[model samples]
Target: MKTTSTDESSAGGVTPVAPDAATLESEKESMLRQPVAVWATALACVFAFMGIGLVDPILPAIAENLDAGPSQVSLLFTSYFAVTAVMMLVTGAVSSRVGGKRTLLTGLTLIVIFAALAGTSGSVGELVAFRAGWGLGNALFVATALAVIVAVASGGRAVAIILYEAALGLGMACGPLVGAVLGDLNWRGPFFGTAVLMLIALLVLVVKLPSTPVTGERTSFAAPLRALRHGGLFGVSFSALFYNFGFFTVLAYTPFLLDSGEYGIGLVFFGWGSALAVFSVFIAPVFQNRVGAANTTMLTLCGLVAVYVLLGVFHGTPWVVTVLVVVSGALLGVNNTMYTEMAMSVSDNPQPVASAAYNFVRWMGGVIAPFASTELAEKFDPSVPYFTAAAAAVVAVTVMLFTRSAVEVHGPHAV
Candidate 1:
């Protein structure tokens, strides 16, 4: 007679055996073993995230070398993010037409060329123009990368997202260090450095990743805008807008506040970025798991307000300012993760369309805050920008509070 395995039961049996420990462990391991194409895309994501903080340590240097005012120099961020926000509208349209592989290559090529051109610029205006082109490339790459990763990765969308977030956190943590090391030599060094690294990523992606076939109907240019009409998506997008104003204010303005040199500034921000990485990857899940995504978002926004207030009050003390900046990173990390999860789940629209709409709206805050913060410091007081940022955080908290029911119905909690 044949013997039955643990997974099998006799006819008319009343009990079933659970999966054995060895089988469960094998399943867990399979989730981590991604294909080569997934790894290549994830590597590219790291380089892309690094670009966000790559200029932080060099901001003051750029100003001094180019003989530009704080407000004018801040336009570097304004130009970059403004173009990125506008380009978000067209990314899905273009990607659906060209297919993901070609789209990735096109975006990477643009970044390589524009970043190199930015490094060669002698004037602030020239740099700003090149940065705008770079922003457009970034918009294309980022919007498509997620869909590709999820399509290719094993263990489903959740695993792919975790890999993406890990790349983001690691890149963010390292960007300042890379900038400081290069920017210490020359302000243009970081720009050139980015170009070189992205070129390598481009090469790896081209060689290793197979071409992804275009599937489904093409996305419309107006799809993202139309997605925003949904109340849940609209609420999350606008709430993130207010939150991002505070986030970018701190990120773009704090270098000027510190009297420390390039290396010191990089070290301080490294600590900040590391804290952000830790909280985003580890702590955020715990908080969201316990309190739910909506409540966690509100709590983090309140934490940001408190941190910004402390920064404003202790503006004169370098040590205090540095400490608060690092602490603020944890708050930012939590908010970023929660907002992203909420945006993805909060609407009935296609996931890519919802993502594009959310990004387009929130990045507008990034475009505004850097230039506005510098102008405010020039006109009113140095600390006014932080106070303004605090106010923005308050607005975010208020929005979340009012939209709590809708957020719960449509947010990560629903998953």
Candidate 2:
């Protein structure tokens, strides 16, 4: 007679040891305290965040060197995201099939390879192609990394979630300035530098990362497309999209503005970037807990209002502009983190789709910011991008307040 493995009947058991789905979940929850898994998850996050942002601060240089103007430059972000959106839809089930760690490693490797290629590219067209490659790796890494962490992290329940969020906060704060300084060396330097960082990150994951089995029924490709048919999360994703447009427009373009010695935009971005990095450490957990994601989102939107209002009002003053950018960057950090978390908080499958949708929103901004801000600047004034971004952030906040919560977020402390 052949013997049966509990492994065979273990998941969603036909005749489970537990009484119901709730009880089974409780039992599995007991196994979540793994330390190595937490570390691996953090490593992966650093790689992706750094990769995503590494080119940011150098947008001015890229535009000048590539023989592209501002509006045209923004296409870098837009096209990269367009690629990611497609990849995210496909990678979820692939992660389920191959296992999260393997999929993550493969994605990380691709990031390293293409990022180096991005650095070597001699022409604008080639650089753009490399960026598209970056988006592909990013979508794969991000789509699966969170789910892996959630399943594997040790100690407190969902400690991986907190760690993952922290890693993102750190990355958002650092990516742009790193791009700025390294950007002075070569536009390619920061990207290649990111590839180096990713290489180290991969090595760390090799020893530390633990594999997690995908538990739920895999949603088919048609499902995500079908999801677009429903409007709520899709709308929220676009809200994030516009916010990125506003933020990155400032982030990417400010250096150029200040390099001209007029608005002192460079100083503004530097200060703003610093504020974002610092605040991310201090108030993230508290803000999320107290105001809740939606309310905090409202608060962040208010900050954007101040940013563009100041930018539009005082386009010529470096001091005033720098102050505004700093405030904007800090609040943008909060907004990015909160909106991302909130977007997922409302989702039924929070980890994977949340990552996918949030990235989608962020990249949409990237795609639009460079071009739209540049175009708007040409027609009306340089400050138009700020105003446009502000208006969009406001719209997103409004919708979240009125919209049904798509996800119910409870941190480890909820119990």
Listed in order, each prediction's TM-score against the native is 0.91, 0.81
lDDT of 2 by residue, 1-415 (tens): 0111267323312211213455434433643445766766676686577665556567767877888876666666766777876787767667766778888988888888888898898877888898889888887887678767765664222244455665775675566657666776777788888889888888888777765566576756544555444455665676677677677677655555555421233334446656765555345445755545556666777778777878877877866776777778678766665655545444444356555655654576666676677778878887777778778777766666664344222211111
- lDDT per residue as tens, model 1, 182-221: 9999999999999998999999999988997777889999
- Weakest 10 consecutive residues, lDDT, candidate 1? 9-18
lDDT, model 1, position 228: 92
lDDT for predicted candidate 2 compared with the true structure: 0.64
lDDT for position 350 in model 2? 38
